[model samples]
Target: MRDIYSNVLVKQSLTPAVRTATATGTAVDRNAGGGAMFQNALVVVTTGVITDATHTITVEDSADGTSYATVAAEYLQGTAPAIVAADDSKTYELGYLGRKRYLRVVSTVAGATTGGAVAALVVLSDPRVTPVVRA
Candidate 1:
């Protein structure tokens, strides 16, 4: 058996302006052969609005960091926590079934009208350990 320590493999931010129905924000590439091993991860997104109204935000992931897939499709309404004005920041924690190499975030709402703003994105990996035997 063997034991592995967990560490912060990567961290980044994506704030691409939305002009069309959808826009790709940014890509997080982890090309380390085995990739980052973890059991859980976290995604933090911050937004600012001209008015205290509702806005929608979505998070996604990609294997290659280029072509992404939707991880969270639900629209984060104003009622949700961390969905407040830009003055404040929202932190979201996401659980993973297995290990993932690449991750990304996408904003459905576009333009200054919606107050779409992203402060930063943080990812956390789980610690892995295995049994060891000695003679």
Candidate 2:
């Protein structure tokens, strides 16, 4: 098996919590570890106890951390999901093929009094440097 723990750097884009409103995740720098460049990225979203709400997950990228925009369709490997109650206790993964230096995940929730427990992780892979250091 491949050594995933050593080759990949994982960043918490969204904090795990019950979100009643929109959640804007933190940007993760692809070159954070010793200026090592990465060629691939994956966004993983995990949910629990979804109520009467529709959560639309958007994947964004930034050339600079201050400015962000939605990732283009050509740069995305899979579509961002409009997560519903039926998707409770499930995980979703989206691959990124863009060459942006920073990335994040945002969840937009609507039509809900009680929201859901949602969180996202940005997984940076194919690092130029081996054994990704802890950040």
Candidate 3:
């Protein structure tokens, strides 16, 4: 049988929290396991209990880990999501195919009075090392 869990590592880019304003996710080091170790990445976003707000999700990349820029459309496998109250209890995934070593997810919240619960996870795969360590 094929084992998917053993070859990949997952990290939280955005901690689960109710947000009322714009939030920039934590930088996920693509080389955390090892230098240039991972060849693929996917950002997964989950939402819960959305209120009177609109949330827009965008993915960004950085080579130096400090300076980041929005990822171009050509390097992304799927479109970033613009979430609304109707999108509550939903999930979205975007694949990153750029060469940057760091990645993050950003959320732009608007017209929010009660805010929304949102979170993001970065899945790193195609590793040069086996059996990724869980932290």
Candidate 4:
């Protein structure tokens, strides 16, 4: 079998931002493959604390990264541990088939007492094109 790593045209795994306060994370353009959107992308959110918190993970897109919009109907693929503190992770499909140029993982979280942090991963691919590094 051929090396699977070569098939991945663009890939990035980032914590993006972690919350100790209520500040929403800044944009993560990553500039993956010169914002080609490639074929598809995968977004995975992993929680750390998640104590009595509510988090909405959504995928957003933009041309200038100044004004953005949601991509999917149910873009928010998962929620925080509401009932039990188990299952503190989720993976969402970031379908870039007909999406825009710039994409980012938006993690909006809120808590009554305190405790919530997450690390996210994004992977993009397009067999015909090569990955580009943004300036």
Residue 108 in candidate 1, Cα distance off native in Å:
1.3
> Candidate 3's error at 43, in angstroms?
0.5
Each candidate's TM vs. the true structure? 0.53, 0.94, 0.93, 0.64
Q: Least accurate stretch of 10 residues (summed lDDT) in model 3?
A: 30-39
lDDT of 4 by residue, 1-120 (tens): 135454454344336344544333345453444554455555655666556556566666677878888665554334322221343544444444435555666655565355465666
In model 2, the Cα lDDT at residue 131 comes to 70
Sort the predicted structures by TM-score, highest score first: 2, 3, 4, 1
CA lDDT scores, all candidates in order:
0.44, 0.89, 0.89, 0.51
Which is superior by TM-score, 2 or 4? 2
lDDT of 3 by residue, 48-99 (tens): 9998798899999999999999999999988899888888899998999899
Q: After superposition, how far is residue 125 of candidate 2 from its true place, in Å?
A: 0.5
**Leading candidate by TM-score:** 2
TM-score of 1: 0.53
| Clash count, one per candidate | 1, 0, 0, 0
Q: Cα RMSD (Å) between model 3 and the true structure?
A: 1.7
Q: How displaced is residue 105 in candidate 4, in Å?
A: 1.3
With candidate 3 superimposed using the best TM-score fit, by how many Å does residue 70's alpha carbon deviate from the native? Answer: 0.5
Model 4 CA deviation exceeding 4 Å by range: 9-31, 34-37, 74-84, 89-97, 131-135
